[model samples]
Target: MTDFASEMRTLIEAIDTHNYNYYTLDRPVVSDAEYDKLYDRLVELEQTTGTTLPNSPTLRVGGELLKGFEPHRHLSRLWSLDKTRDKDGLNAWLTRVLKLVGDYNKNNPEQPLPHPTFVVELKFDGLTLNLTYDQGRLVQASTRGNGAVGEGILEQVKTIRSVPLEIPYKDGIIEVQGEGLMFLSVLDQYNQTAAEPLKNARNAAAGALRNLNPKTTAQRKLNAFFYNIGYSDNIRFDNHQEMVAFLKDNRFKVSPDTNYFDSIDDVMSQLEKIGSERLSYDFLIDGAVVKVADMRTREVLGYTDKFPRWAIAFKFEAEEVTTVLESVSWEVGRTGKITPVARVEPVDLAGVTVQNCTLNNIGDIERKNLKHALGSLVYIRRSNDVIPEILGKATEESDGEEIVCPTQCPACGTELEQRGAHLFCPNRLGCRPQMIGRITHFASRDAMDIDTFSVMTAEQLYQECGVRDPADLYKLTYDDLINLDRFGEKKANKLLAAFDKSKECDLSSFLFALGIPNTGKTTTRVLADHFGSLEKVMHASIEELISLHDVGGIVADSIYTFFRDPLMQDSIARMQAAGVQPRAEEKPAAAADESHPFFGKTIVLTGTLSAMSRDEAADRLEALGAKVTGSVSKKTDIVIAGESAGSKLAKAQSLGIRVIDDEQELLELLGLQQS
Candidate 1:
């Protein structure tokens, strides 16, 4: 062979190895710049030699846009699994499998099969992909069209870095089945700069794979996890475990969630555990798949008309559902931002009847193709137990009335102003909804911690007592609240006492209570710690505010603009006149001790801590130099799990992060108990 051909071959092999190490193993041996240099050199060599290897990594950049997909027949049928929604249904399926095995064993006592063990895998909520490999080279890729035939999308599939282009098993043809998915984190990143943000990760992946332009698919940054070897000419496995091992051995991206259980009950228990941590996953999963482990047992008990009898899918409660968009109503928030709340036709989703869904803003409405969606079916997703969100229209073609954006504020009829993606009412004082929302937020537990104060109290004070803002709350007298409905002498006095107590709150809580636009609890705390007092924060310039950690230009501008507003300045003056004293947070003595157990660690507290509120614990931990956060992540050093610790604890355990479930141990760390 010529030296040029040999060099090209060497580069191809090296690039492919790097791709396998980076994508499949997720342990890149070289930096991205180093890998790029290798890739660029190979591209240069290919261009000079006028030769591109079939399995070259450069093809992963994507080829010319395809006109349309072509149909490809599979060697083996990709059979679907029968689904069971509840434990009873799963138990019934298991009973049937055991009975079949027993009958077979009775008929052939001399050659009894081993008792069936089950393997459970996550049922990923993404597009099903079937890849065909001939002599270890990826020959074709397709969707699960009809079990036998599928639309070929080889070029699009190549763009997925996780999908192997070539394998070590070079004996003959092989076919593997996996799910194509866009990671939620990747989708969020794409949406940050995308002209029209993708609604959800699943659709982003499926749509990209089906798009005619391979470049579009590459832009989605898709990934896949191979779980099944559907067909193989020169390989055989005695069990599902062996098949999974073979796939992993050939540099396939396999999920670490695959587990084997000897008992059906254990499978159910594992499914429950998976369900708890489902939301914590970067990719979506609607359910779990339970299958017989033994290959011979699967063959003997498989092949129903539509599903594999040996395997069953245990589906969780649906998080996404279609509902009719009845009407759109704008609600003014504490910041005067007008949010479009859609009253959808009541639909059961994720175990609750969801009637209302958020459209986010006018931009979201238009971007999601929901502008003409009134009285039309829309897809609503309720994930992470928050309010359901309207993803997009159920169909591309709309047949309903247009969703008109309100020109005036729905609460006080003030002319609305358009800000980037949202509409806001400039009249912060006269807007009744805005006033009530602001006052209620100010008295919230996380804000001023005013006890006996509720939304009802805010509304009563707003309507009857003439309380227009947070400053107005400080001005309320015993007579002002006593005459209001449901506010007798005792309740009025209690409210007055709570308001008095709230006046002495720390600056962080005070800043948070002000309901500054774009500023959250963490930002308020950071501002308080940096500026030391409300006066300093109010006088801070945009540049000075931006210099603080976590405060961006937008937030700094918001703070500068808010404090300069004449109405806001008057409100602050009124609050000061009414004796609302916001004291600066006490600084920790010297620097935090480096030897402290929780010092300099990022900690997450989940569930109920009986010793103290999570907020109080977070404050104490912060005093000890620990950064307390809400969510569990790979960066988290410790997770303090209390009673009934749910998804966060489950996620921390799954990630192999350290977890402290004992309340006493946590108390010791907080210095509340004798060490």
Candidate 2:
């Protein structure tokens, strides 16, 4: 007997340690070959002994794919926390808690109660997952689908290397509750290869874990952090801090930023700190969770019909301000879509002088219960510090007239067409705004790389030289440029030279410059990669387009319809005649050595680089056969993070992705030593 059981135990422990290092720490001590050797040995021992650990790394290989998830009832119901956006709400709740405690003390005067303390943690904006472990061995995992009955996803749960399959505690059953989350970087990575791109991180996490294919879930790299103990047979704690300590001891990833507040003011201050630092977090946080620290106080407070009385979620308010609605204007986009923009009284918002905000559409106005009256106090919200929007009217009474949508196009005076909730101008040939928008887009940095071009210049050219579209810019002569105001001989020569230089732009940028509806930078790149030429992309059929990954029916139909337009085809032809032929899409570079760290990997660069400019680093990475991307995602294999790197750096750390220090390290990783 070769002590098969003992050997298996040792193997499992070694593999688990490696998994922790690689997956959680992003620091691998052993080579892949060595790790594989250990895994193979474990498999051999397990087969010889006819005993296998539930959390063994070999089980991650998984069995047959599940058809559908079966509904599994949770041992105890999971309740949602009551939410509030105001500090006063917390005060009121705390007052109620004190009243209950005061009554408890009154009944038992001899047993005087001390002051209550609160524990605060970040409330992650993600799906809730309940995990069950029997005798300290991982057994089942389910979603908080209705709080009572949830879909079982044990197979997918096992794919998350962070979740412990087996722990040291071997006494009783414990059900742990955690937030199932996907980092923004991971979601971006998944979208790079997935046929259907996910809308956001939260949705991606939910879809991945709910998927029947454990392989797909594993590839998504879903992560979880335990927050609460839903059901425990033998475990008992006097306070929440002790419970958190136990979870940390068991190697469960809990919130490292949890704080104990002695007073309500202190809790509110902590909430403020949490809200202020929200952008620095790797995962999405909608708010902060405030809970009574004492477990005895929680028991005394008990549960409401839906939420526990002892806990509350303090949601952060949207960055908003009240501004008087001066008027509304409609602007025509390149796609001929007419958008209603709100011209408001100049108010400072997010440190910017705000004037105009999007009204979206008639449906949006209706949904927001807006009267659209001029001079109405409108509530403008800047959510996530992005674009500001007219959330709704602050008051019902207005001093000015009701807003009227334009029946005719704002730019060309053509009759507008209504499609669902959107308004569009069909006069693509004559609309000035449409022409301006399209020409500006075509000359943008991501498009033709016409760095000196501007919308003002585009407008001037269209008005003075009869340059109606992008193709007309290529047709401009020295005389035409010299005739325009502020057009010096030097500027004119530079403009002409830039226009000529744009002909060599890659097929991807050329397609994006076309401004096709439902097409973005990523889609344009994928389309260019698939077709390899402009002609193929323009002539691609709807069915052919839809067959490609990430190209759904809507996008396919839009691209197909755009290419079929006789005007568009004629414009493309005109450009082709003017020596504006774009280069064919380049194939991914082949690496000389497969062992190169950056080879065949997608890398992102962020912040100010001391060794070189961001673009220079990107160029070097691409030269080494690595895909240099603008954003960080789960699909990103490496991030060359530099000084003062913000959210992307935080996200890379959160997902446990490798972050290179400088340009030299990046070059070294690519196996390109400094010459």
Candidate 3:
């Protein structure tokens, strides 16, 4: 085993040095991968050691137990810089800088403006934090709280290994300012389990920074790029570039999207270059920042009320691409909500390959005004940081009226019922598309342990091989799948093996896999634990479903709604008839398991988890006979906070519930240790 102490120190040194170079001096000597390896190694060691230094990398992620936040004063009066939200404002700011540099030349007559007169850099969209390093050690970090008065998060800041527990620069007083952003790779993992995934990187960053547990925060893989020295003097630079270069030399993370420009036009060129390059980078940035190059000109130009008089952030317009919309297809889910996917001539948007984009509901399709026949150029846009969304018609001239909802199910030729804008296939057990959606959703990692039954394969099974529902999925044979397109011998066997494994998943997973309307993971868990068997919930009355704590009137209504249909009930009978057993272990009629850490205690799960998958952890927690609930209420005994854990963490604090991490509390409870 590697010595946790030694590796932790080394990563702190390397990452700190790298940050010093990138953020402080505007120069970097290492690749992002190398930096990540060092950081991950340090995190691993810390997890194993569990011996925390006040300045240890783990401590910076924020403690789960919010001690209490009181309004605090700022050391200096913080003020907002004057901001320019568009290119014109940038042009105006550049004009001011040029005039100032020209005036300085006229005043001194001897000093000349630098040939390369401006620094253009990408402006990141993230939280700004202030780090105070005293005698080579990070003393505290605070949010640019109100830019003046900020909350003290000294303990939390210690978790960012790159934040540098100790800087090599001794006896130097420097406060570094940087924007904190969560990486994209981390965000995708979060979206899979998130009930409401973040819309963009800024949202992810906001969630991560506010996380109560530093351990949970660490999992997000947040990075920072220092843009300025909030306070540091005596060390001088000939130009802004030199100052950026100096910060890089001092071991701070810096933005790579920086360019030198001798004129406004040249700055514009760099800004355009950044526009093209922005999608390739991991962090979310709205636009490029332009600043006067002359060191003295920056001082002379000074501040506007909300932004720098000498600096401006010129934002790029949201990226739009024209593509031929080849087809408008309806994706009918198990719940009968139809989402129109605009299949287009394969076009690239931002960084992702985009051949399809959502048209939301039937109304959304009408608003876009795509007539039944397909080929039309449509405007598609996604903020460099957002999911690709269709931006209406690229063809401005169109007498296009909305396509009528199909009278029959496109897949099964059954009648469609119009409740609202949505056309539902009330033929629940008979709809092929609905069956495909339900089976795929059931086998998904969140619902059950079906390892490799992909949506594509599920569709193939339904359409080609005569499989309709999840119960039908259990009847699939290896040869049946192998006969389909692209299903070679090996993958078919692998998929079949996965299906076999899924059959054995605990009854709770089976119930969740059923994809019953309004039956989410929590409700399924409660029902399973209460009834101890799928047979009971199948026979449950509306009153019995309502008796569960998490199930209120709406949920009760949904359960009764699912059971009211003879076909739906017959389908459950069929699943049972097919030998698929769904049953939960009923909690014994007893007070609480004191040994069951969360028994009789109210608990709330917030954010995301690493190590044990969030669903698996929650399942295991309930298995231990604990009451796992959503949202932190006053009755909550503990809060299991995860990565990007949001408002629940705050509410838990307001209610004074003890909070624990997924890795620490949940994993340990489940007998899995995070390393």
Candidate 4:
């Protein structure tokens, strides 16, 4: 009997190893027949001994149907994340976090918190799962019904091949949090043979996991990716990196796309990249989550009434839906380009009512076969949180009334000219929409940043004050604005003051306000920085412009042509004559001593400094030519540790790099005396 039990244990371990290799790693070393032989041997040995191990692979085939799910109280509460849809919202959240950290540091000088770093992970669009493990064996699995408790689905969760039935950590009880998902490919395969196809992958995974029959759940072939060890009795992680390492060591399948960053700017860039590649993944993701990397920082930030304050979900705005295209209309832009706007039946998408979608141009309309799509169901997607865009018709065979392209400008009745894929109105000086759009863009925040400016203001000035061009804005008199319907003496004076203040603007803002075709804020800034003066940028050739970073052939041509245009040149001359002094940004002076200790060193700053914030220290280091990074690796030359320094300091010490723990010494190195 002891021999049979021992053989059963060996066979169970072998089968579990094979299952992990086949499902989690996606690399099967044994043939299907060999795996079947091992599984059969384990079943036979268990029958002979009449005692099945708790973690045996044979148990994964599932048990008899459960009557109903039991309630489970979680060891620790699972917190949801605060969400932001745009960069502005994200910046606001970051501002609040920094302010909170600053407030906390001011109140608790003895235990000042470290600068908050971040870890970004994909926010999977599926059911949240919490698994309980005790004595190294999977004890219970449940959905995250509420933060406090949930319905136990242990039998159904056992069907997930990637989930570990037993972990190497056998000390005590722990609760792991993750998402249970159905891969897009798996959903496709299941739908191909199913009598009733699952409409969505997220709903399919949720419905399967919540099903009463474990056998039905097993048939769906679900998968899961563990992220957080929410509850641990015998383990503690100092940071997110340590927690992730622990999860990986115990055979939990974690996402490899998880990344770490020290600055919010880098995190925003990563979120943008992830949003761009959202559709490339095998699973569905609605957003990316940004969490404070340090566990102590998370604790300090703590939880709000509903979500964790330390973490925020940057949600992507693109959501596809089908709506009927009612009709098409033509609209003129600031550049005199005529675009087709499709009026669709109002549909709620991504929390907004989308009634209008862009058809790009005549060429796009023809290419997408949308010219005959009026009164037909079409697929529309809200991309980047701007206007919803019409992708195409819902069905390939769907067709309706042919959309007629206008031959004259809708705003000024000027005959249109075909330029590549677009139809342009040549009457740039007379078109009302074009003139108003240009003036409004000129006063935009990224441009001149004029106060009290709006499209209505532009229209009032155009109709009543004869301010047709942007340069005409400078010519407005007190009598001209105060005579308008809603303008008061105080409002007129404020507008005039804003105009005067906008004259002493930087070169980048002046260039961006020009509304040059195909050139945005980034391109204009690059031009201003590279050329350093308006005259040099205006005189630059196509070849010179093309050599700058991010400047393509079309953009270079637009810049060159815009500068050479007689109207644009005249406008610039008028603006300059109106006391507009566009100055180049002042460059920082070189460090006084090239041999400064911080110069040219790869430095890592950890923990909290009582004297100054981490950003200020990083800025000073950067000015002295030191590269201050987030993490400590072999390439790191020095580590400056302050109070409460954690894993990074330990790693630096273990690597035998130079360490500076004394605040007085650090101040001295930075060319300052301790206060």
Candidate 5:
């Protein structure tokens, strides 16, 4: 065991160094062949030893797709900055800062201070990412989800070429925070071959980082610019300039246009310069951050409940352009909701050319009081780094008629029905868009776990083979697939194998894969657990479904209505005939041992655990007959508290309920072993 450990440590160190050189420095010390050889050896040793370190480089080669993102407690809280757009607001903020500093200096005469220096930086229009490194090796990366907690995206972040996989500073643990963005050039290149082009760079970057597959992010050429240190152990910075310098010294990318200003006027001048030149950069910037550079001054100012008082974001007004609305087209979704898409004359938004934007629905149009006549001018705003949205009417037209809502489904010509504020096409069986969307959802990675299916394949199957539903996917033969465009024998066989593999999925997945209206994964699990069989669920009444804890009246009615459709019943029959029957687990209450500690007990889990993800832990606890609730309440029998546990743990303590700190202890209490 010691020998294996020694070998593993050496391999990890070598691999990490190579990764740092290749990913961070953009220079390869070793050839790809040599690196892969070392990586393969490390993987083999890890498998044999059955022990892997948290910072193992092999984890970057992400395997199975995740069910969903798990919440992670951050080492340091990430706070949002208060924002202002106009000169009046900026001046007011600056005045307040000056007054506060003067007061602080007067109160503390022993610590006389000079005029505060401010660091001005263009705020990159991208998703916030927090990266933590231990002993100079990157360990974890997460999103700024709710300031206190975030979703872990270490695997995806590792694929970003610009982020250093390893750093020179090995003094304890430190956190580097930055924005992850995709450049406009990269976006344009991606759109040329992308199936569905990204709407904007910011959303594209966010979506790529959150994607379950790291390879997808690597392919997108995502980049990052480190700006601040969220946490450090033994490292200190006197000012924000030093922090940026430290980041640059460690081979991490820093913003190229950061400037230090002593006065608000100089800061405002820099902001103007940045705003004017920001459009010329490869990436997007929506605003400039003006921060008190001196760390002492920042500490004196401190923070409010939501934002930092030491800093403020100077936002640029969203670029608005007026263009002629040529036409309004209705697009149908998988759920039968029809969305109004406006086709406008081409106009420049920021730098990208904009010709189309979402008008949302008939209600949105009415709320905006927009004229629906041809050649009428309409205003669109590309705000908050999102796809340009129709803002309001641009012209006080003298003779333009109101845009009339479509009476029929655009795809199947079926008459539309009004549901709440949206219009729906009820032709579930005949509508092409709905059928295609359902097929796509059913074959989605989270549903049946069919990774090889694509929208193009679904379209081909529908048009050529007369396939209308997901169950028909199983009926596809190798010959049939081979006959389709671009499907060779090898591809056909692989697709066939994926279908066969999906049949072995669990009951919850099968239920979710059915594309029932208003039924998400959680609701699907409730139905699967309550019924224990697909047949039972299909026959159960609304009263039975509504009785389940997670299912409400609307969801119950939707489930009841779905099963009552004869067409859906026929599809299920076809699916079963095609060999797609998923095995259901025995009811937890019935199968669980009565002597288990968690038996018939409500449990609440809070914070981060080192042993496994919260989702996995919850599943295990539930298997031991524990009911895992989200919040702490009087009914909570036990609270499994991990590191950095917050309000839920406090609530449990106040209620005098039992709490377990070690995950192993909790597992032992439930008579289970490590997963």
Candidate 6:
């Protein structure tokens, strides 16, 4: 008989070593396949021998429902901040800090500035939470609700794998303050479904942490970066970087975007640099947290009843300055979908001047029920900085009655229908805006990416050069382009070269460029792969289209509608006429490989899964050939689980869920035979 208990012990020790390697040290010695085998073996022994260990990862991988959130009185009170939103305000804040540091005499408002040191860090856009761990096990997680009475999530907090159920600290009890965040890509993948994706990372973290099911929270991949010491009885760190390094060594993920500054001026420069690098980070970063270096000096400087006087967060304003709306313009998309845009007075944001903000579709305008008219004050926000959105109406008096969606296309005067909140021009053919938008989409880089032609140039070619469609772009001569504004001979030649180069971008970009309604880049990739060529897609029936992954009802409707549109058909005809053919989709890239070890199998992960969450199983499986199917069908190859699996367990039993407990079974199913 295999001494199952001893095997389980060895497996736990090995898996824990790997966890330390990957999550703590940011280095992994073993492949996920190798790790999976060890994990599965441990589970197998534990189940067969009925032996479970303390702080077992299986129990700790996912958090459970909290009894309820309770208020935790701070060791030191958490304080609300006095914020500075712009350059002038930052200068003022610096001026005040210098005064507190005795840069000025009591009577002097303006004096020579004193040399002071500062720290700058990216202000992560996440929900603020205070975590308390007792003897390595997380005891309480509290929200920074109003800087005081935070909702406690005892059970839910346990689900986050990153939040260790136990730590190796000897302080007995350690309280840390940090931010909980989710990745934008995760949110976007979720948004693909009919259900709305989370609006932002902070909200996602807060909501997920508050969920009753530890499994759902586990699936979210919520991670945290410890930044501040809220309370600790015997902890000691010399400086901020020391704290960071120590936390990482002790299993907490630390922010990697931080830098050391020798002086306050250097810190400010770093702050400016953070503004530029903010958009590039994988996690949310709203601004930088600046702190003084020396622990003794920091103690001497002390803190307010709230924040440390030695540290301050320089927050980048996500909201653009108020701009006056000069007009509301309705523009038609290539699909003949009309959207309202607010043309506003230019106001500086971050570093650029803002003018126009999307009102989304007409439905958004009515849902928010914006009441502003020409000359009304409107606030613009680009919280994530891709698209600027109208915050709300700022004026009491209406300049004119609220503008309503037009019943006809302004460009072609075609009859329109109200589909949801959008007013669509049923006459998709020959509508001026629709045709131009189509041309723009076709030329856009995500599509065929004809680099040479721009929307404005396309317009000029349309009205002045008799180029009414995409095929006409290839017919343009340098002499004709040179005749246009900003188009010198050199510029014209470059544009033509780019347009010619677009031929090689592949079928996915080509289909996306077609700009069919609701058919985004991912959908195009799926369609191109399934059909093998653009020609096949053009001939495929709606039923076949619906069978493809991500071809929801709206996309199916759009596919059918686009093919039926004489204008859309004409455009496709012209593209074929001009030799813009979509190539067959290459093999679907495996998210992982044989070292990944489980590519094509269907794994129905249910309940609280130990070792990793259900989501991690699906993610890892997808990387292999393991399709992480949502529901267990008769086809489900494995059902891996943790404690208290409900309906899924019953259904899996009825449908033969191939239930596997512990990690080793899963590893064997994936064919990982560990030593």
Which portions of model 5 miss their true places by more than 4 Å? 1-119, 126-283, 300-309, 312-317, 348-351, 398-404, 472-495, 529-532, 539-544, 547-550, 584-675
TM-scores of the candidates in the order shown? 0.51, 0.52, 0.50, 0.51, 0.59, 0.47
Q: Relative to the unseen true structure, what is the C-alpha lDDT of residue 510 in candidate 5, on a scale of 0 to 100?
A: 88
TM-score ranking from best candidate downward: 5, 2, 4, 1, 3, 6
Candidate 4 lDDT for residue 116: 85
lDDT tens readout by residue for model 5, 1-675: 999989898997898778666755557999999999999999999999899876577665555666767777778887767778867788888788889899988999899556778888878877788999999988889887646667888888977767877788998999899989998999999999999887668667877888877777777888888899999988988888889889978878887788888788888888888777767988988889989899988888888755688899888877788987788888999889999988889988876688888777898888776755556877888644335778877876634556778899989999999998889999988999999999988987768989688888789899999888887888888878888888898898899999999988788888888888877665677777778889999999888987787666888899999999888898889989988887675644548645455678888778666545565677777776778765577877889987547677998889999787644344334332232
Evaluate all candidate structures by whole-model CA lDDT and list the values in order: 0.84, 0.79, 0.67, 0.83, 0.80, 0.66
CA shift at 272, candidate 5, in angstroms? 7.0
Best by TM-score: 5
**lDDT value, residue 564 of candidate 3:** 69
Q: How many backbone clashes can be found in candidate 3? A: 43
* TM match of model 5 to true structure: 0.59
Off by over 4 Å in 1: 320-675
lDDT of 1 by residue, 323-413 (tens): 8999999888888898988899998664356888766788879988998999898998864323477888998887989988899988889
lDDT of 2 by residue, 1-675 (tens): 458777887888999888776765567899999999999999988888787766688777545689998878889877767777888899899988899899998897886566799999998766677999899888999887546667788998888887888877788999999977887778778789989877566656777787788888888787787888888989999999989888877767787778998999999999999989976777777789999999988888898755789999898876689998898888889889988888899887643467988777877777776655687888887553335678888877655567788899988999999986799999988998888999999998878889689999999998999988799998899998997899999999999999999988898889889998877665777788789989889889989998876477878999999999898898899999999887766667555334334567888777656434565666666665777765667887888876546677999999988776533334324322121
The local distance difference test score of model 6 is: 0.66
lDDT for model 3? 0.67
RMSD to the true structure for each prediction, in A, is 26.7, 19.4, 14.6, 22.4, 12.2, 23.0
In candidate 2, stretches whose alpha carbon ends up further than 4 angstroms from where it belongs are 1-5, 21-37, 43-52, 319-404, 408-675
